[model samples]
Target chain A: MALSADESSRLGELLTSRAEQVTQQWTEIIAGQLRGRLSQAELVRQVQELHRAMVDALGKGTVDLNGEEATELRAVLAEFSRGQARQGFSATETATGVFALKEALLAVLEVDQSIETLRDYVAFSTLIDQMGLFTFESFVRTRESLIADQAEQLLELSTPVVKLWEGVVAVPLVGTLDSARAQVVMERLLQTLVDTGSPYAIIDITGVPAVDTQVAQHILKTVVAARLMGADCIISGIRPQIAQTIVALGIEFGDIATKASLADALRHVLRLTGVETARRQPRREA
Target chain B: MERVPILKIGDILLVSIQVDMSDQTAVALQEDLAERIVETGCHGVIIDITALDIVDSFVGRMLSTIASISRVLDAETVVVGMRPAVAITLVELGLSLNGIRTALNVERGMELIAIERADEPYDERDDGPIPEPTASP
Candidate 1:
């Protein structure tokens, strides 16, 4: 129902005259609902700003929400939602802050015994409800994007390819070997191989918790890629358990070298690169 | 038809692919490389793909075929200087270029060929240190 200009002006005047009382009641309701989760100063400022925006929107008489009059209200709501997410407020709790304004306005309107006051009250309630839901949605979206960014950072940190020697590079695999991480592992290892002109690569999976058929296939595919790049790969840090798992799964590593430790892999690479170390004679015990 | 030039350095044949490769070009390269390997009696082949931006499956297969044919001719094949993107794309496309050797550059490729040709006790790192001669008294 369209609110007549007369009714809108009357409601606007009531909001202005009772601004202090309405804001006080609204602040109390929000503070009680939030229960000391947010700083009192911040809560008071946000509540006062929202109260003013709502009053202005009502005065404009364009409460269609999507109407231009609600633009300021939408901006305030979005900023409030983002702040709540940053402050660790749940969506429900944030929405409750907006909803509490309705209670405060109703209490202020209780003094007037007129049907027009009641009608104005209903229209304000609907507007606040829409604002509450919008805040909740914006809060959820902000939280989701934050989570995705952190996950990407963790993925990058997990995969690091380091050159171990003049002609050798090593990737010490940790955690589970999912396809996504496997692709990262392959890409970094191959790029390092090309960059350093290393003909030997060691993929150490000792930090990995378990090896299944899929993990084995990912490893084999990586080994094949290194070979194509002119580097022979050695699978290192293969614990006895992983060895048995490989056998049980019938996964053949073919001619690819397998070593029990990184040291052994390094020694093997050194030998391939023509680095022969001479041993010293043992000293007599004292 | 522009032919990707094959330059021979000593007993090694070097082919630097500086042009975007079409399927016909890759095929011609395979045939030309095989003929060059035979004519030069080269012991090693180094194909530098650092200049090529993309290596689709067709070119990837051609690389594998070149390695195999060179192997049959008794010449070790080393594909060198593959771009990072091409390597990732090739692996994603599920072609590992197995049966091929890779080097980071032409120099490393030459070193690999030298090592292969050296035929010294290459795999054995543990020959007991020669017994020190007894000190002259």
Candidate 2:
């Protein structure tokens, strides 16, 4: 049905007010739920449900408002926005927690924009998103710093590799392989492969103080990522506990070439390629 | 041999090292670095390899080994200053100083060390005995 000019104006105002109400509700819901201090799984589920309920309450169509009601609706929406903007703690991205709140806020904020002129709404939404994105960027940066802090403490190793060698790059690792350092080791190994021209890299963990499935998996991925890049990767550090963890975690690393030591792996590489090691003596004459 | 007093920055130990990495002296230089780290009770060791033109496997292995041993002593290690070409050569030879720490110079290494030490329990005395490097098989 074609609407009269008065009705169209009324519809836009109604939509605008509804959007603002929904956004305010989103902030409230997030704060209330967070205050509950629920477990991560519970928190995510609650947020999802809350989002659904708000969407349902707003309904799909126009909420008719008289010209006078239109003015009141606009004021109510402004009030709600101020309320929303006034409060909101730092968003956590670990469980997509902050993302969830942002998502809910945007959904309602979009409603207001939709009711307004197209160009105005676009600018508004973009500005809001930029602010939200900046917040999110800082949150991710903080998370990365926390992780790197742990890495420095545990790995006692160094460098962000410029690139991975394409042929063979040997990494001889010693000491205990904690999860944080293990991840750094894994990333460096893989990144070095991706960055360099080398095809085969050896990660000799003969000096690793200990290991578990997590560390083993880190080793496993370096090899896998290497193969994905068309390189043969070798892992040379297999402590007894690491082997047992693979069994315990049921982690399978059958594809990676495992050797007992770096020198041993280098020898095997020479053997397979029909190249004699410089250190190997010629066959002794009887 | 030039000696610089060791500076304690929080829980980390930083000792500035001056090793001339000339082709003739690189081996002795490596030993000197390894010894200073062992002697100074530092938790993070930075070896300045900025003085050399060419770096061969022996020096590379020494750097890599120094990093490994420091970890045993609960210290992080970094090797800095090889000519760009030498860095490329080390990569080409597959003598990856992998799983070992690296820095552009002594200053950056110390900055990293400072970051490492800042996390210790505040107010706790850092005056404990030097941590002994673990025995290798």
Candidate 3:
């Protein structure tokens, strides 16, 4: 059955958060649950099959697993029942645990459905009715609504690391940089700069996606914000697409240092104080 | 470009791919997604692309990068429903996905994460071929 708008959004948020905690970050807590399973290979294959099921889910033609496939699975499991996990990581993947997990998740969803009365976001409810359109896309559109709920509630941005070096703090952004994140990055970096009383903050987005007007604006905002905090902000990691976007947007980052990578940005940042040789390894997300 | 939510099986964020996401929107999406991943606190993000025809390098890079950053921000990323052709392009580019993971389909990725969560081991056992579950007629 369909859940109410408020109920769905709330439940959606809960599920979303819990899911992220387990899957996104490596949790040391779940390590011991996978010691003994009825069968490991069969389970892995089951997991693989489940993923395959998500691809064409409804569309991929189906065959009854009840016939030969089920028999084959049993045979495979019998052949490979030695260990529950690979080299390591079994405490978290117990076969009984997985079976319970499946049941628990289904139970969770059921519980979530019971709270669907309050209207959280109208659009989210619309998404629910439109069967095929309510998955990941809703997450994108409903983001603004979600973020408005709280600062750290939505998604986790980098924990601003305010590094002090010769009275300067530098923040380097790596990986596919986008506008929304760039906005968040800008806010956090600037706030940290102000909070730490650092005169220079460097933002390296070499890892950012194709730069566009929005990203350029975000850079501009960071620079401006840093200036407001009585600090200087350096922009680096401007990819080709981003450069093109900046030019297209006709926005000039006045006095902003643009570099090719985080290392280049660091060199420039360090060179500002005539200490160009001070080199330390910069950490970038993978 | 329209965004759709397909299903959320636990922490796996299942999204329907936009058949046509422009370069700008693609980046915006990565941005938007970055925000969502942080907001929803979902563990894994899955983008199903069976409905899509052609996704440029921009989209691929954005998704890959977003997936990585999302993970750093406490979310794993997965691209599902990718057509075979799209898969070939991604591999040929020698893209730097590094820690970002993907599956032939969303369910597979979810299964992996779930199994990973379950800490299911490196099982050499092949469960033969899974018979496709029949869609309701």
Candidate 4:
């Protein structure tokens, strides 16, 4: 509900004239809720800024919470919510900071019994409620994006392609192979294959926890993709249990090579490239 | 009027596809190469596609056909230097170029062809165990 022009002017005068009282009461309410989790000086400054913006909006006759006049107030609330979210404040706790203003304003407006003041007071309460919900929504959105960014970084970190030899590279996978991660693995492996022009790649899955049919299919798809780029893929680290699972599932890797360990796979690739690993002898009795 | 050139190197035929081939051009190349393979009696064919960016189903099918034709002529066909993007797109487009051998580059492709030719006729003496290399004791 919007406050009438006259009511808006009357409330605006009350808010600005009684600004100190409103800030005091609002700080007390929020400080009580936060219990010194945030410093008193910080809390007081935020309360004062919100109170001043609300008063300024009321004076400008901006009763609509989403109107152009409320832009500054919205931006302040968004920043506040984002900060609170990063500071480890719960959603309820962060939202209570806005809700507490309603109580503070009510206490200040109750000193008078005028009908116009009562109407403006209710409008103010509704505006604060909308603003509070907006802050909570912004907080949740920021946290979600932060988590998504970290998850992407983790995915990229876990799938590192190392050049094991002149014409060979290896991807040491160490986690669950979901469809998304599988796509990343496929893309990175293909790109690395082209960059290195390596004819051989070893996909070491020893660190991979387990492999079902779906995982086996992902591995096969990756191998086929690499082979399409002229690089043969050797899937190493086929544990006895994983081997049993593959056989039980009737999943055939066909011509794609499989190895029991990374070392054996490396040796196979080395032999394929015809680079024999010869050991040197010690000098005669030093 | 653009035609992919087929060069004869010893007993091997080298075809480097440099143009964006239309279906007609791809078919022409296939015909011309098959004729040249017979005329020259080449034992190996190397198709270098390093410059060809997009290998749609038409070009891909042409490659498979070329490989099949060369096989009938007692020659091995090796496709080499397929870009990563083209390979990925080909797979996504449901064309794996099955039965077609691929190599990293033309040199490797030639080596592959040489190996294939060297191993032909199945000599029993060639199958004997290789002697180990040992340093002087």
Candidate 5:
């Protein structure tokens, strides 16, 4: 609800006159809600900043939070909730931090009991509720962006193309293969082949728990892309159950060599390159 | 039209595509490569596309057609040095460049051509099973 002109001015005057008392009570109420998780000094600082912004906004006769005059107030509230979100505070705790100002204002209005005072208190309470909702929105936004950043990092960390030999590289997939991750794996594997001039690549799925048809299609696409870049890719580390799943799903790897282990794939590559690896004989004891 | 230069290195003709492949340029390169193969009597053709950042469907089809032409002329055509991004884009576009052999680089391409040329007499006995190590007495 938009605050009326007289109510906004009177509330602004009351807040300005009792700024110290109102902020102290607001901080104390929030500290109780938090149960000592946030430091008293930091909480007090945030409460004081919020109090000044609110008084400034109301003094300018801002009817709603979206007014240009209340920009500072909106910024302060957003900053407060973003900090709470990063600090792992719940939405209710962050919103309650904004709502606590209403209780503080009510304490100040308790001395004057009239019909006008009750109306002013309700109008002021609605404004504080608007601020609480705004804080909740910013908190949720910050949390969502934080999650998106972590997921991007995980995608980067999951698809690492490492050099196994002079001309052989490997991508050890450790999680489920989605289209995005598969695209990353394909691009990275092909880039590594071009950068290192690797003629052979081994895609190890030993850490992958399952393989459906979609995953098989992704793997096949990656292999074909690598082959187009003039690198042979060997699908390795096929677990017994995963092998059975592949057959049951009717997914054909189609002439791309599949090995039981990375070692076998490497051996096949080495032999293809004419590198004979013979077993060493034991020395006789003297 | 910028003609792609075809250099003769031993028995393999190396066509390094340093220019962007326009429709006319691609057609011209195909014609020039076929004539060079016939005149030089080269047994292998290596088309290096390392500098090519983009390979659309047209270029992909050109490569396949050139491979077919060289094959009919008794020359093995190997497209080498395809960049990873181009390869991924081609696969995404569903163009595998069929009938065109591929190698990682020009050196590997030459090696591939050498192996194919010597395929009939090349011995596979060396890659046979290795004998087990004997136990010490």
Candidate 6:
């Protein structure tokens, strides 16, 4: 329920009169919940900022948390929750930090047993509940964005087109080839082919654990895309089981070269490029 | 319509398409390339698309038609320098530019044409062992 003008002023006066005690109690409660994961001084500073913002909002007679007067309060709460999230705190623990204020307020309100004080406590408890929910939401948002950034970084880190030879590049795919990663691999490999003008590319799937039909299809599409750009793609690193699986699945690589290993693939490309590597032999005569 | 210039380098006609291809421009290119091939009697044609950012179906068909026309005129055509994005788009669209040879760049394209031309005389010769004349009485 929205706080009336009288209730707002009464709560503001109550908070201001016992500001030091309330903030101290609130900080202690949060510190106990965090179990020293956060330092005592930092916790006290955060609690003081939140306490001051709330009092300022109440002083302006703000009924709803969405009111213009509550802007500072919301900002303080959002920053606190975001900070907590980045520190690896759980959502419940972060929300508890805000909810601890209710306990601190109840301790102060328990001294006054009047029915009017009881009603004011309930209204103030609802406001604190709203603030806890706001903190929870921002915490989740911060966590979600953190996950998204990590996912992008992982995608970039996984697919690397490295030059293995003068006119040959290789993409050593080390993980599962999902559609998204496959698309990235295809684009990066093709772009590298154009940028480096490498006529040959070796897609070493040694790191690929399994070759399902879908994975094979992604690989085929990449090879075809590279071919269309006038570059030849050789699929290397075929595990024995993967070869069996490929044949059993009736997936035809059809004219696109497949090698047993990256070395074999490199040798094949070198031969095609007419770079003869003379094999070393031991002398028969001493 | 902007005319795509065709440069004749030795026995190969080089067409570097730098502008966006409209229908009229593509047709003009087809006509110009055909005339240039006959006038120079070039044995090879290299179409460089390094600057073309897009190659829709129309341009694709134009390439195929030009390839077919040059083949009829006893010349080989090699399409080179297609951008990766355009290649992906074409592959997605299922246009593989059939009957047209492709190379990585202009240098490779020239090498390809030279290789084919050099092999032509050998291909015409019968390298297999000759059969002994029958001694029928």
lDDT (C-alpha) at residue A110 in model 2: 63
Error of 3 at B134 (Å): 99
Give RMSD (Å) of candidate 4 vs. truth: 5.4
Question: How many angstroms is residue A87 displaced in model 2 relative to the true structure, after the best TM-score fit?
Answer: 42
- Please state the error at residue A102 of candidate 3 in Å: 21
Backbone clashes counted, model 6:
0
For model 1, the interface Cα RMSD in angstroms equals 1.9
Candidate 2 is graded, for docking, as incorrect
- In model 4 chain A, the worst 10-residue window by lDDT is A2-11
Cα lDDT tens digits, model 1, A78-144, are 8999999988888888898889888888999998879978888887676667788888998998899
Model 1 chain A poorest ten-residue lDDT run = A1-10
TM-score of chain A of 6: 0.95
Q: Pick the candidate with the highest DockQ.
A: 5
Task: Indicate the residue-level lDDT of B27 in model 6.
Answer: 88
Ranking, lDDT, top scorer first: 6, 5, 4, 1, 2, 3
| Candidates 1 onward: DockQ, in order | 0.49, 0.01, 0.01, 0.52, 0.68, 0.61
TM-score (C-alpha, index-matched) for candidate 6: 0.91
Of the pair 1 and 5, which is ahead by DockQ? 5
Clashing pairs in 4: none
Off by over 4 Å in 3: A1-154, A157-159, A162-164, A175-180, A276-286, B1-137
Provide the global lDDT of candidate 2 against the true structure. Answer: 0.53
Better model by DockQ, 1 or 2? 1
lDDT of 5 by residue, B91-131 (tens): 88999888889999999999999889888565432448778
In the range A1-286, model 6's lDDT, one tens digit per residue, is 7788788888899889999889988888887777668888888888888888989989888888888889989999999999999999999999999899888989999998999889999888878889999999999999999999999999999999999989999999999999999889988999899889899999999999999999999998888888877889999999999999999999999999999999999999999999988978978896
Candidate 1 accuracy as TM-score: 0.84
Error of 1 at A159 (Å): 1.5
**Model 6 C-alpha lDDT versus the unseen true structure:** 0.91
Instruction: Kindly list the per-residue Cα lDDT of model 4 for residues A121-213, writing each as its tens digit.
Output: 887777778888898899999889889999989998999999999989999999999888988888888888877778899999998888998
Look at candidate 4 and tell me the lDDT of residue A95: 94
